[model samples]
Structures are given as C-alpha cells and as structure tokens.
Target: MLAIAEYVVRGALSGAIYALLAVPMSLMFVTVRTIDFAVGAYALIAAAVCWSVGGALGLAAGLGAAMACAAFMAIIFLALKRLGCEDHIIYALASFGLATALASLVLWWWGTQAFVRDAFSDPWSVGGIRLAPQGVINFALILLLVGALHLLIQHTSLGRMMRAAAANQTGAALASIPVQGIQVGTYLAGGLLGGLAGLLVLYSAGLDFTAPLGLTLSGFGAAIIFGIGSPLRGFFGGLAMGIAQALAAGYASAMVAGMVPFLFVLLVLTTSRFGEEALAGGRP
Candidate 1:
C-alpha cells in the first residue's frame, strides 16, 4: 500500500507536465475547433534549445522558438481559412505536417541526442516517499498556470469573449469580437504552455526528437479523458494518465507501461460521449 501511494505521488508530480501540455490542446480545441499537432513539437524545440543554450537566456530562447513555431502555425491556419478550408481534419493534418517538419529539423540540427537536464542531484524525502524537487516544482507551476487560466477564462472580459467565440464564432463576430485574433492568441498561448511543458520535461524525465508525436497524443488523450471542455478536466486527466502509467511500470512490463496511455485513449474514444461527438463532428 505504501508503495502504491508513492507511485501515485510520483505519478501525480510527473503528470503535471502532461497537464501543462493538455492545456494548449484543450484551449485550441475549444477556441478554434481544431487540434494543434505541433504543440508537442513546440515542446521538443523548446527543450532542445534550452538544452543547448542553458540558463535564463536559454529559457527565453526556448520559449521564443516555440512561440515562433506557433506563429508559423497561425499563419498556416489563416491561409487555410482564406482558401476556404473549413474542415477540422485539414487543420489537424496541417499541424501534423508542421510537427513532422519540426521533428526533422531537430534531428538534422541536434542529431539523435536526447535532451535532458538535472536540476537536483539528490532526491527529497517527503512522508516516507522519495520525491524529486523538480517534479514538485513542475506540479506547483502547473497548478499556478492552470489557476490563472481558469480565472482568465471564467472571470475576465477577455475570458467572456473567448467563451463567446468558442460557443459561437459567428455570434461572437456579430458582437464585434475578434474571433480570429482570439484563436491566434490561443495558438500563441499553446506555444507558451507547450514550451513550458518541454522545459519542465527537460528538467524531469527529458525527451528526444522522436517524442513530439507521442507527447501530442498523450496530451490529446489527457484532454479527452474527462472532457476537452476545460483545462481543469485536462489537469485531472493528466494525473490519471500519469498514475496509470506509473502503476503499469511498477507492476507490469515496460511494454505495458508504454501502452497505458494509448490504451486510455482507445478506451475513451470507444466508450465515451466525447468520442461519439467527435466522430459526428457535432462540436463544429
């Protein structure tokens, strides 16, 4: 039982980064009715840049690279819209292309070296369970960001406009709300959040060039686990995913541990209302 508790704690902490990744996914889905497959790429590039640069300047450079990538995605999105491409699948495919391109770029520039960094040399003991300070920091930071996002979405006038845009883009436009601008803003926010997640991962478990697609899928799975309606659900979903993966790793084979997240995604897609609605394109 104690062991189980420890795993849960560790998983929750690690899941914080996943939650950070999920926030952008949820935001993009709600605001633009599309998925940004390049989100994970944003994370990967950030981590790579941070690993190369190091220190405070690296952090800034990492974030800048991520947001710049997202800006490119925004430009593509606008171009698609101008070309009368209203299909959500097209947006997803476009982002997937961008993700692939970014991954290739990373591979070419950084080679196959894994991006990782250690913030602490020793583990901290808490309540009979050992924890990494970096993991705890990731969890705390995610909570702070999520809280701020909730307030931004629920309390502020800008939040109201975002909600209005999400609920009905035409109506929001009729009200003179800048719907496209809001979506562009959401993409930029995704870049910031995704880049942050990458940095956290760099200091925690780290990742490589091949990680972007998997990260994107993990975030998408987390977002839809409870519902993609809000970032709070994404947060919980990320924790659930992390716990499940940790438990799988504890008692199950490495293969099973890896399969845990994809399994959750499959379960949700097959048995949930969100899946049904998604298949039917009801949201759009």
Candidate 2:
C-alpha cells in the first residue's frame, strides 16, 4: 500500500515534466495546424546551449541561452513559411534537417556527454517516501505556465484569433487577422516550450546527443494520445498520457514498460473513443 503511494508520487513528478514538455506541441498544433517533427531537437539544442552558458555564467544566463536558441528556431519556421511552403509534413521534414544540423553542432561543441547542474538539488524524502525537489519545482512551474497559456488561449482575443487562423487560414485572412504573425507565434511558442523542456531534462538527467530525438518521440506520442490537435483538451490530455506512461513504468516489466506508451497509443487508435471526444483530448 505504502509502496503504491510512493510510486504514485514518483509518477506524478515525472508525469508533470512530460506534460510540460508536451504542451508546446499541443498548443502549436491546435493553434497553427502545423506539426514540428523536430520539436525534440529544438529542445536538445536548448539543453546544450543552456549547459554551455550555465557553465560560463549562471542559471539565469543559461535560460537566456535557451531562449536565444528558441528565437533562432522562430526564424527558421517563418523563413520556411515565407518561402511559399507551409505544408505540415514538408515543414516537419525541414525541421528534421535542422535537427540533424543541431545534433552535429552539439557534437562539435560539447561532444557526446552529460552535464551536471549543482543547484538542481536532490530529491526530498517524507514519511518514508522520496521526492526530487527539482522535480517538484519543475512540476509546479509547468502547471503555472500551462494554466496561464490555457487561460490566454481561452480568454484573450489573441487566442480567438489564433483559433480562427488555425481553422481556416484563408478565411481568417479575409477576416483581417494577421495569419503570418500568429503562425510565427505558434512556432515560437513551440520552440520555447521545447527548449525549456530540454533544459529541464538536462537538470533531471544527463545530456546525450541522440536523446533529443527519443524525447521528441516520447512527447509526440503523449501529445497524440492527449489530442493535442485540439487545444481545449491539451492539458489533461497530456497529463493523462504522462500519467499512463508513469503507471506503466512503475508497475510493469522493463520491456513492457518500455512499450506501454506506444502500445497504449495503438490501443487508443483501435477504439472509437479516441476518435470521439477530441475536444476533451481524445482524437479522431
């Protein structure tokens, strides 16, 4: 019983991180109708740059570096759009190229290795249960950010405009919404969220060159399960997916645990429920 509770806490911590990582993709897809296959690479580069900058300056400075990386990503997305091409799959392919280039850049600069963040601190223990302080902090911060983003989307005129643009770009243009600026914002938001996740991952785990791609896949799976294509359900959708993964890892065998996320997604697709209630996170 106590073991179950302990594992639950652990799951929540990790699940929150995954949720945070998933939000940007969800928001962007919901708002812009574009997919970024390289979302994970954007994060990887952010982590590397953060580590590099943090090494020289401080945590704040490292964050700046991550933001700068995201800013660069913003440029790439817009540049491609301006080139008269914005197909989801096509843009995602270009993102792949950037991912490869980023990976190479990381190898050139940092080599294939991990980093250590001293202030990240150790996990805290209570009532015979252990918890990571950094993990808790990350979780809380994400909640705040996600909540704010959701509120902004749901309540603000800008959010309405975004939804309008996402649904019908041409119609929205006829309606006089700045479709291009909104698109850029969507990509920028995606990049920033991904970059932040990358930095958090580094703080949580050591860095590796190939890890970003894997993390991107992980985030992508969770987003799909959560119906990220629809904004209203994104938060709990991502949360539920993260929690499902957490539970699988905690209770199942290593191999099965490794397969749980993907397997669950496949299961979701098999059922009609996934197609229905997309507004609530399930997808069609």
Candidate 3:
C-alpha cells in the first residue's frame, strides 16, 4: 500500500539521523571500549549554542561546545587510566555520573525552553512523496561523514594504531603504539561525531534540554542491535529502528510508536544471535 511506502520512506530518513547520532557512541565503544553516557548531552549543548547565536557563528559555537564536552569526557577517561582502572563497569559508572552532571549544567545554563530553528525549509517531492529538504541533507551528510570516518579507520596508519590499542592496550604499548595518544584521539573523534549529530538534530527537530537522553537511547539501541563492532551495521540498525517506529506510530498509537524502538531491540536480542555476537564484536 501507498501508506506503507510512505512510512518506510519517512522512517528511513529519521532512522538515518539516529544512525548518525549512534555512530559516535558506537565508535567509542568499538575503538576505545568506552561508553559515553553523555553522548546525548554533547548534541544538546551544541544545538542550544547554535540556536542562541544563530547563523554560522551559532554553528561554530555549537560544535565548540560539543568539543568541549568531549574534552571533558577525555579528561575523565585519562584520570581513570591514571588510577589504573580498566574495568568497563567503572567507566560506565563514571560516564553515567558525568552525563548526569553535564546534562544538569546544560539545563542550568540554557533553561528548559525548546528552540525551533529553520532548517532545510524546502521540501522535495518525488512521485507523490513529500520529503523535507533538511531530512535529506541530514541523511546524505551523515552517510558521507560516516563513510569518511570509516575510511580513516580502515585504511589509515593512525586508525590502525587506534584499533591495535583497542584490541589490546598492553600489547599495543609493547608493539610501540602510543596507547595513551590513541585513547585520547578516539575520545576526541567520538566527540566530533557527537557534535555533528547534534547539529543535524537541531535542523531536524527543535532543540531541547531533554533531547539528549532520547537521542542517546535511540543511538544506543541502534548500536546494540547492529553490533557496536560494526559502525556500518549501526547505521543500518538505526534505519530499521526508524522504519519500525514510523510504522508503529502510523498504524498503532504515538505512545506505542515511542516504545517501538526498544521493543524491536528486544525482539532482536531474543531472536537474533547476531545481535549478541555483534555486541561482543565477534563475527556473526
């Protein structure tokens, strides 16, 4: 049916945005073996800064905020390393607290007001389907960036060093790889991706203090479903999540739609061994 086609298209667009947001988290997890619970806050603060300043200046401000947030996370990670803490749960606890604190700070600074910015104000029509220009731009730009990042990781010397460090920090150090530097670089790269996603989210939806958590959840779920080991899979997972959520909203209820992403994740976890193996970064 035409309705089904429409849902699929719209969902895919939204899903692409989610994929972008998820990529940073996935990148961190896969490369650094770290989870930045504050990934969403980076996006929120960037968007807020962009809206407050407006124009190109606002965009720069937004990105800067994201970088700053990433720096803060990197500092935390560095501190943990200094203390000889390599346990992931410890990092998770620290990241959770960091996320909460950063979110609170953003709220204190920006207040709870939602911002609506004009983005891709044009709509493109294709064979009776209406699509927002911003949405298309979001999808295209994100994929391009993701692809570039992928190439950097797959083909570059720095990327190989990072991957080597990720696979075994001690071994990497023994192999003459700069493990500490690689860790810092990974965190910074993750932050950059997070900031970029935030800018895109601002264009897609009005920026809000609470936007980060939802974005984080969507991205986290997508990454988990697709296997954090494979960034490409994370992108596809987000697309699938978006399509399912769209269908749920169109055919069921808005509340149900909101729950659809997690439900789909649950379904994947229960029925698909691939999801688990992928989470573990093993071949499916």
> lDDT for every model?
0.88, 0.69, 0.80
> Estimated TM-score per prediction?
0.93, 0.87, 0.94
- Candidate 3 overall lDDT versus native: 0.80
| Candidate 2: segments with Cα more than 4 A from true spot | 55-61, 120-122, 230-232, 275-284
* Ranking of models by lDDT: 1, 3, 2
List runs of model 1 lying over 4 Å from the truth. 253-255, 268-284
Best-performing candidate as measured by lDDT: 1
lDDT of 1 by residue, 72-144 (tens): 9999999999999989889989999999999999999999999999989999999989888999988998999
Query: What are the per-residue Cα lDDT tens digits for candidate 2 across 47-155?
Result: 7777777654545554555456556666777787778776776766776777777778778888978755655456688788877677778778887888888788878
Model 2 has how many clashing residue pairs?
2
- Of models 1 and 3, which has the larger TM-score? 3
TM-score of 3: 0.94
Clashes per candidate (backbone, < 3 Å): 0, 2, 0
- Supply the global lDDT for candidate 1: 0.88
Q: What tens digits encode model 3's per-residue C-alpha lDDT throughout 82-115? A: 8999897787677678777777887898788886
